[model samples]
Target: MVETDKPKQHRSRVLEGMAHAVSQKGYGDTTIADIVREASVSRRTFYEHFSSKAECLVALYEAASHNSLKVLRDAIDPAHEWQTQVERALAAYLGSMQANPVLVRTLFIEILHLGPEGLAARRRVNSVVADFILSMVNGSKGPKSHVLSSGMATAIVGGINELVLEYIEQDKVKYLDELVQPASDLVHAITRT
Candidate 1:
């Protein structure tokens, strides 16, 4: 049992190191050597953790989602208007991305090439955001209270994700406040209690 657990722990460490390296060097440029070096582990150790770079990326996506979800949860306020809630969530996400631009680029753009795992991670984040929005519209009762389609919720979150990416990549926020109103409006317009 101990030996089995060791591999799992090492895998997490390797994934974390890869995320850090990719954040700095980008996924395309990052190599296995860089990941193992970042983890301070030997080549054999890395192989024990993952079969290849793609597997490492799968783990990285999970890590990034966990971090992003924490930030989003903190931004939520039960007392705030649904509009304000959306704004706060967007602000929180964008702020996090701005603070960790390299990580954002790796998770959002680079790691996508890793196939199913990467795509699933992205979808998981989107679902989280949709659920958050649904909560605001439905209150504690959940989807039963809000009549919005799942498709609409997905679209709104996707748009928000794209917008956040643009804001991060361009290194400019010409009118940051505008993002809030539109984001809130989009959610409010679609959601009916």
Candidate 2:
């Protein structure tokens, strides 16, 4: 029987190496050889782990998003007010993005240059974020606005995503807290009946 655990472990190492390589070279420019070389594995090993560079990028994106979601959830206390929770979540996401700027850059910008597979992966990430925001707003303290809910949630998520992209582009995360209120306000405005 094939050793499943060995393949899983090798795939993980390849993913880490791809993240490192892309963080330096970017997604559009990175090649299979670049990944395998940085990973210190042979071409066959790279193929064994991933079918293409796009797959590696998608895996990298999934890993980063998963980690950021955990950080965001941990940043808020369950007992806090809805707005406070929003602020905490935003702060956590921005903070994590700032800390791992390379990951954010590669996942957002570089992934865009790839084929349909990468785009689909990005859409999946966006859908996950959208769903999370929807759940949070729907569960907020006060009454919910069914009519504006979807647009409001999309706006909130899009705004935060753009702000994070800007932070990564500028190489600075100054005034992350300042962004929270405006983001919250935008959400409120959009959702208010």
Candidate 3:
């Protein structure tokens, strides 16, 4: 591999190893050895990129969150009706989650058990999502009387997270797209009022 590609390859392997390790053993029970073994790398190689498993998990979560946000952003269309945009965004968000159930499960479930740092990461991701929703709502509101507030945007993000969590807990992740209509409707009601 090229010199620069080495770090990227190692990081990708570590993240993939994290997903596999967590999926097999649960994040709480997985160890550095398990991750290294899963990645087919030495312990020293793992440490070169991450100080600890928690840090690795945070990196995994951040990468996934960034990719998901890109999907949501790309799905938006200025020419579309606001409600349609909402539906499309929600669908794209859920679709990305559905495409990566292992990572999604680790993110929405396992990462929560990582304590304060994990919570902070989760909140940071949620804030990004909320900001995206807020921007979409603001852009589409135009001169409409009803407008969504920042607090409302946060609540909406929380609500959508809850909905996704429920589906994940039920082992129905494939049905995530089913949430698009309800989520869009919720946004519609909140934005119209």
Residue 178, candidate 2: C-alpha displacement in angstroms:
5.7
What overall lDDT goes with each candidate model?
A: 0.72, 0.73, 0.87
Top of the candidates by TM-score: 3
Which residue ranges in model 1 land beyond 4 Å of their true spot? 1-12, 79-81, 140-146, 171-182
Please identify model 2 stretches exceeding 4 Å from their true place: 1-6, 141-148, 173-178
List the lowest-lDDT window of 10 residues for candidate 3.
Answer: 139-148
| RMSD to the hidden true structure, all candidates | 4.2, 3.3, 1.6
Task: Quote the RMSD, in angstroms, for model 1.
Answer: 4.2
TM-score each candidate.
0.75, 0.82, 0.93
Candidate 2: clashing residue pairs, number: 0
The order of the candidates by lDDT, greatest first, is: 3, 2, 1
Error of 1 at 88 (Å): 2.3
